[model samples]
Target chain A: MRRIVTLLLALVCLAACTKSAGSDALVVGTEAAFPPFESVATDGSLEGFDIDLMRAFGAHINREVTFSSRDFSALIPDLQAGRIDAIASGMSRTKERAHVVLFSRPYARVATGVLVSTQRVADAAGLEALEGDDVVIAVQRKTTGEEKAETRFPNAQIRVYDREVDAAAEVAAGRAHALVYDMVSIVNLHAQHPETTRIIDTELGIELYAVALPLGSELAPALDAFLAAETRPGGKVDELLAKWLGDAERFRATEE
Target chain B: MTAQRERLVRGAVVMAIIAALAIVISLAPGEIRWALAWERRDLFLTGLGLTVVISSGAVGIGLILGVIAALFRVSRSVALDQIGRTYVEVVRGTPFLVQLYLWYWCIAQALQLHGLFGPREAAIVGAIGLGVFGGAYIAEVVRGAIESIDRGQWEAARSLGLSHAQALRHVVLPQCARRLLPPLTGEAVSIVKESSLLSIIGVAEITYHAKNLQAREYETWAAFICLAALYLVVTLPLTLLTRRMERRLAGEEALPVARL
Candidate 1:
């Protein structure tokens, strides 16, 4: 009788294990190369403002949140193919991207900034100085920075790297005249190459950072509700902002 | 070319073209849509043009480096041979992508740091990286071809009052040409394929544009399929040339006098 009971329990457990996954878990895809928002820590695990915030949301909603690292460009396509649940990378909610994917309410604000060699810090007072034909502006491919460079500096040559760090390296090494990227990345670049590179004070335009979800996703409302609550004063978003970025007041975009 | 062989080559080329097209059409996500990408054909064309330029530049520099390194490898001096061996071993042992980063960032940065050379265009740096990477394998290929020439040929030339350099230049080196052609053409095709790596460093090659198109258009499969087709178009001639050289060499082997 005991043996029969053990056999029946084993069969039930096997059947439960073989059940289909019905969205109890959220697989968040992120490009960890973007510091502050998301990046790989020394322990070879993902840790950043976005990673923590996603985890917090998972805790609140009573679901398991898993993280996957991907190239910045591959995140959206992966989401569309049902390979990932949400994109928590430092992706801007631009009109072009919004057309294809649903974006959560703005969680963070970013603006375009130029990073130049230390010698050209004063000369490159604004984007106008970088509009010359001889100027070579470095940008990460398929980013808003590339679009801005193309529209803002028609005469200036544009060089696109796979990673923003490479473009920053180009500017730091003096191979390229300037790097046009997100203000946070520009600040990070200046921090990394303090002696060789500096960030321009002028911000091009305000851009919003948000969590991207697949079109018509059931999780959109829950994500937006979470973001709405967290973005308030003394909320989780403020805590994250203070923790990741110290006194980045000037770089913040005025929410419209 | 023999009539039958030419016909065979032609048939193979047509079939390859058809197969390439079929693969692109079949692999497209959902309904086949070419107009979305075709409307932006200029992007692909520009990328193809840049790829050609980079590959040509890299091949030019690689040939020069390969020749110099091959001479060191084949040299009778121990120091020269050691230098050649070290370069080939070091370069061949490492990954091409890492070498490219070293070239673009570390080495190039050092040059700029010391004021030895000013900022260079990424394309120029990328071409040099590809050249340096290709030079190692090319050096080995060239060295092998030169060594394959019989020891008696060198002895005969030296016996006829020719200096060591003259014997190598006039007799052994010239005879190595037949053996070198097929392999050299093979290397050229590889260089073309390897040029795709330059996209990482911002050379704006075909692969770069393809990636951009994919990300922007969200036609991931279409973008890469077009990229594949473009690469095939570029490498097809070199592949054919390699085959032709191998065939010609095989036919010529039956007649010893014709080999010369």
Candidate 2:
């Protein structure tokens, strides 16, 4: 009977649906708020160094990479839950984070610095000069820059902001005395608001950015291999740095 | 069966159904294992407590502001009524998240210039933001409930030589309270859900803690399921209580509605 055959077909489809279908597509999670790393444009398209790198890596690995934007704090959890295959946000590799998720090879090195209002302070020597009870520093929450600012300037009142732009804006608006963040982001902010803000010539410390993966994930080794080949002399990484950073010499200087 | 006995039986059956479904979902080998969430109960509980505290604080503030705004809205004075109407329209028109940011980032900055508050303490600002936002909706509810009462009640109170304030306080508001209860409960639930937005500014509420667990454990399904269950625990009781209150106020027999 046609009805019996139809019932049999329906049961077969239901059975197939119950079992998880394995796919080769890679779901990459990113916090698109960090510009030049991963940022969403006005048209809702993702554009940044991290986006391009992931697409290039996906091509190298022969997998269809799908990107999902999430809160910066939620990216790792989404990855661990298998909701995402990997993270391509500009996340720095640290010992504490390595306990939970595997990290790919370091893609780029960046120094932390302070951004101060040009009108407020004429010249700043280093991190110590800016340290005092009266000076209030703004830093993005859950960042190494925040940690560094806390330790380096214990006397200074620290204001933690959810977004790097907000922290920079506080300094620009003259509410906060200075903003502590990665040098690349500070430079970008200064470029955008040159008259209001200036990057203080203080090198806090160097940190390396890498892709985060779930622990014991098969994708980890593959991403690491791709990063190794692509970041070699005059490779894809150099191309990205030139395109986004504008001056490859500054990023290259800290390479060694 | 007696009406009270029947209601008790119905309540038991519903609870049993919920329990059986929970057991089946937890024991089933699938993407969402409730056990994963059960293990992180402490973290979730802390988040829930914070959520309740923030929402209740907002609700408390909202009630006072709502009453004042409603009074102003129905007042004889044109200026006061216009001010009240504008406050409700402006607040209700904007998204809560934008209002939150406006309070946290812009207004907080302005306040800091006057040395009144610090921008770093965002939780207080978030509670105040939720309160101000909820007050607009609550004002409408209060006005509607007050207006729903017959104009005869007001005239009767005036004939009894009661002033407008005395009549509103003694005669009309008591009637409005019963009509207001269900919607006020709904507003309270919404306030609890909206408290999740506070997590954006890092308030360490339930959603924020859930994200922390998800990020750390990498179990999104389990983390979110737990989050949903925790919220249900907070909201379900209020919903049942509201239903019971509505039934009691209606003077209906204590008969349970039949289930499928």
Candidate 3:
């Protein structure tokens, strides 16, 4: 117990010291499991649409950007507590969230999609068709998908996972009837496991994605201006969208 | 220091520490509200019920596997001894989280049994994973307890015309029971704590519910504190019971062995 207490005290001191020392660097928290937005590459480096955009914004402001990978649910609490200056994960901006954090202008629009086993693609065509007591739906924790599953399929068995990939894997394994997650991630999972999983035709409503900062943060105006300037045609946002998502009709249809 | 003074000092120190902690929590921030978690008590209660069920299932499985493995280790046959040792070593060597995934996703899928599996099947697999992982340590504990008995007891029973199996039932196992109690209780408590790892596989236990609540409500500290408290509610009684048993057994240790 004494040794554990000593170790904890040392850790607290270290955290305090490092936090004070890195005031100049902007710390951004992200959950890197969502593909096309934020994900770790095979080579152990962070690379994705959100990552590139955050780095571009950091360059615009002339501050060094440091990315910290955390659980999806932890991003907001970390930002509120000042552990991270901003959140750039593929998080949808909602009214409930806007009450707690300052959201910059919407950067992109994405829709929730459903994934099912290839064999069930013909039968389970939409979310409504799978609403039953026996149907098992897999959703990533803290995502809009979980919210939708709770409200839509009130009787379905909902299994929550930390990552979309795991939920998709459940669909691929035939353990779960469907996976409710962002269309981009669902597309990514279908590409990776083409033989086992297929996309459902029904698309959930489009949601605006934005960067979240602590309430009344000084960084809000600058972030908004940066987003406004870079989201136009042939700007950094367009280039990132082209580079990461390409001109796929399914993706373009989700664009606002 | 006098004994009375020592007790008073200890009591004062504990109260002071608790007071300091309370002050720290109170000073944190307006957003850190504990009441937000209290409203979702139903989620936590259901999760705790599942946690108890999983732990009980694991304990039942572990006790059965442990005894069998212990017997194999103490047996004279080389093949049985090798199988016992290999089972213990392999289970103990791997991380429990990886083992859980291998059991739920890989092994269950390969058997073609998980296609229709849901929460119920997931809970059963979680229990089996925890039990298989814990059986190794329980095997060692039971083996050591059995070995602690004097070999002369077996010889005396045999000379008295008792069969090998009868000698074990009449002479060895009674003494082994007392020695096994403490370690077995400890193993059971450890299994209860280890059941938290089942949350990753989607068993809706206390930690799983806590994570969901934390994610949805963003009450990280409140959600986790409630989880820790629920675990303590289950584990503290077991720990206290073991301590009482150990005390009673310690007194019995002073008495002479019962006459054969």
Q: For this target, which candidate reaches the highest TM-score against the unseen true structure? A: 3
Residues B103-156, candidate 2: write the lDDT tens digits.
Answer: 866775555521222222456678889999999999999999899878988998
Considering TM-score, where higher is better, how would the candidates rank from best to worst?
Answer: 3, 1, 2
Q: Can you write out model 3's per-residue Cα lDDT over A1-256, one digit (the tens) per residue?
A: 5975786477446545644564688878787666667764423356788899999999999999877666677678656645578999988888889999998887877888888886554554666667878888999888889998888789989999976656776787788988888887787777766777888888877777899999999999999899888876667887888888874233331232
| Model 1: lDDT of residue B19 | 93
TM-score of chain A of each: 0.86, 0.85, 0.88
> Between the candidate structures 2 and 3, which one is better when assessed by TM-score?
3
| 1 versus 3: better lDDT goes to | 3
Off by over 4 Å in 2: A1-24, A252-256, B1-260
Q: Which ten residues in a row are the worst by lDDT in model 3 chain A?
A: A247-256
lDDT of 2 at B246: 82
Clashing pairs in 2: A77-B214, A77-B215, A80-B218, A81-B218
- Indicate the residue-level lDDT of A196 in model 3: 78
Alpha-carbon TM-score of each model against the true structure: 0.51, 0.51, 0.53
Per-model root-mean-square deviation over C-alphas:
23.6, 22.2, 22.7
Model 1 agreement with the true structure over A29-90: per-residue lDDT tens digits: 88766777876543335688889989999998999997876567767765675557899987
Quote the positional error of residue B221 for candidate 3 in Å: 0.7
lDDT of 3 at A96: 86
